[model samples]
Target: MLKPSIDSLMTKINSKYTLVTVSAYRARRLRENPELFQKSEKSTSVNYVGMALEEIDSEKLTYEVRDKDETTS
Candidate 1:
């Protein structure tokens, strides 16, 4: 019989994770109070059409305003 090392066991433990589904309202609730959930930093790159997120200072933050002026010839 062979035994796995401590590092191998730790790697297995870190590799496994559980995911849960939440409704939009429930998501809002969770977002409003992030301290209630086990938090993790998620890094993602997104290509948006017209809006840009410049800051997120608070739990419920919003982006800045942009002027939309499209002149049709």
Candidate 2:
């Protein structure tokens, strides 16, 4: 077995989902065999592996006011 570089590990963590913890197991597996990762399924909704960074735009979020008519005075 070979050792993985710290830079490679950091890259994986940095690329992972912001709200989720990057799996060490998956990271190691990825480094060991990247082909396996390609065939794997991302069951987690927050998984960022196969997603594009630009897909998560801030403008997509919206907020609404409820029962605010009483404050118009």
**lDDT scores in order:** 0.27, 0.34
Question: Which ten contiguous residues of candidate 1 have the minimum total lDDT?
Answer: 48-57
Candidate 2 has a TM-score of 0.23
Runs off by more than 4 Å, candidate 1: 1-22, 39-73
lDDT of 1 by residue, 1-73 (tens): 2122334333323321210111233345445664433322431312210001101211222323245654433
Who wins the TM-score comparison?
A: 2
Can you give the TM-score per candidate against the true fold?
A: 0.21, 0.23
Tens digit per residue, CA lDDT, model 2, 1-73: 2122334444434443431233443444455665453331332223333221111221121123358787776
